[model samples]
Target: MIKTNTKKICIVVSSLGVGGAERSSALLSEMLFDLDFDVHIVSVLDKIDYPYKGKLLNLGKLKAEDDSKMGRFKRLKIFKNYLKAHKFDYVIDNRTRIGLFKELIVSKWIYNAKNTIYCVRSYNTDMYIYPSKFFAKLLYGSAYKIVSVSKAIAEKLNNEFGFKNLEVIHNQVAIDAEELLVKKTIKDNYILFFGRLNDDIKNISLLLEAYSKSKLPHNSVKLKILGNGKDKMMLKQKSDTLGLSNHVEFLEFLVNPYPFVEAAFFTVLTSRFEGFPRALVESLSVGTPVISVDCKSGPNEIIVNEKNGLLVENHNIEALTNAMNRMLEDKNLYLQCKSNAQKSIEKFSKSTIGQQWKTILK
Candidate 1:
């Protein structure tokens, strides 16, 4: 059902998997579709797991990799032809464009500045691993606009790249209190931690240590760790070593984790760094208060200390433990925070974030 008068938009990303950036792109595409825009997705890897709107253009199918040196160029040619044929009003690129040569070629020649919007999801330093700072500065300095998901990210990008057209458009998630209330969930009470089991980034070990030290376990409170990864065994072993094998449980990733989220007393995130932690927002959306480490980019922006959740110092196990104890002992504060959670996150609603995209794209 394409509208004759609608403007066509193409969202470009590495893949539409379960990552934060992928989810953001999917949510934005859905919202834009609702607003009568014809949306299209360009996934480099052809890996799409998120629900989205519009046609999908998988450049990876070009088998460019099978061709070696000239494959990427051939794929780019095919993509260019598609863009020319569709005459897309805008191409919002959400992929990390840190590979200077390829990204510069794609951003500069494949897509013109006026028709493309570059997105920066992570902190400035983490955006690209290769090339020098000067190269990153030059690469994004030429875009029509650079979109950052959080103010902290935006500031870091500005301080480093100083892009002339950097814009802050926070990532969004849907929040429906009535709907969440109706969803069937487990009757057991537990504190939840959901997301990848990556210890280096997610720091599940920190969470385990904090929980083991907290007084909640003494009160028969269970800590449930959800999501799967390579570090699952190591984290489980750590839990065992800490004598929390009985109290801390490790669970596999669930497609619909909202029911578990709803059933929790509260949720916790102990990430080393984040683009924008969707877990915190999702937890708050379902009326479950959160306690997160005030990490590099996301937690501080979302969690108002003692308001909707508590923000502990980054990498401080003692502080994290204290925060968990506080949430358990301070019943009045926890109730107040839970009561205010849903209303506080309304600004991040689909409609609001969609409107921001509309303004930026226009």
Candidate 2:
């Protein structure tokens, strides 16, 4: 038996604002606290709007003190100082890149943490294509265990980088099916495309095009978008140019947006990448069927392709249109997936996966 009295853990991150890593850390902190571990967070970034009520030590946002350059030795020293002062049993780093928050300094200085775990929330394979992959690899050994949010992430770590010592612990989430089935005042005919609208990586531009051609009646078929990012204005402008102004609705960020999850017929995700969308899993928990592009890993693992959800060819709008249409027109297929949607998410429920993390901490 593990010693319940001996439990002490620390989760370190740039900030607990709005991101997958923050959400995961928040949920896991709550779960670990329930299990009686003395949990605390070390926020290395400016004010963490810490949603979780656990103890948060605000280290008064460190100043780089040296340079305005994107990466310079001055900023690195500030991060190095933060790690030296605060100590813990284990350190869980959530920053995805090496240089973003001076995370490398923490890992290198606090190398004595009994267990240092890094949470990988993005597709590890494409790190090379995106900025910072090569640098992140350099900091790999500063941690004892790497917690990958999905198998694709883990495989990328192993296959591409030849790194070992990994574990797969999906995010834990749940939703109420009865609550999710409520019809909005708006008609049921509208399809939805939610997520960071501005990011080209989500292929929202393609989604707008495919949706424009959809037989989903222009009057009845509106696309509701949620979340904000750098490309928000650009996407909205593109929607106007495509003559799809009436078809798309942009919603500002929400503090508690589960109703959006409940209101839609199904959640739509067209990301060029994902670790495992915690939002998709939560939507499925509420019995919402999803039509997602077959991204590298997350969708295929959770969605059974016409079983619990519909998986379409990645980056192809025609295929996305056909799949979306099938969900709308084919009542039998829709019902088949609807019936399985809530049930398919059993593996990622709090009892199952949350306990898995508890096991890790213990």
Candidate 1 deviates by what RMSD?
2.3
Highest lDDT: which candidate? 1
**Mind giving the per-residue lDDT tens digits that candidate 1 earns over 1-362?**
95764689998888887576777788777888888898998888766777788889987666645656688778888888888899998888888765668877886678977777888777635664223667665665666888888889888876765667888888888744454655764666699999878888899889888888899899999999988888999988999999998898888776567888988999999988887888999999889999999887888888889999998898999999999998899999999889988877888888888789889767
Instruction: Please tell me which predicted candidate would have the highest TM-score against the true structure.
Output: 1
Q: What clash count does candidate 2 reach? A: 1
- Candidate 2 residues lying further than 4 Å off, grouped into runs, are 1-5, 47-50, 59-87, 100-104, 124-138, 175-189
Q: Rate the local accuracy (lDDT) of all candidates.
A: 0.82, 0.70
Looking at candidate 1, the ten consecutive residues that score lowest on lDDT are 123-132
lDDT of 1: 0.82
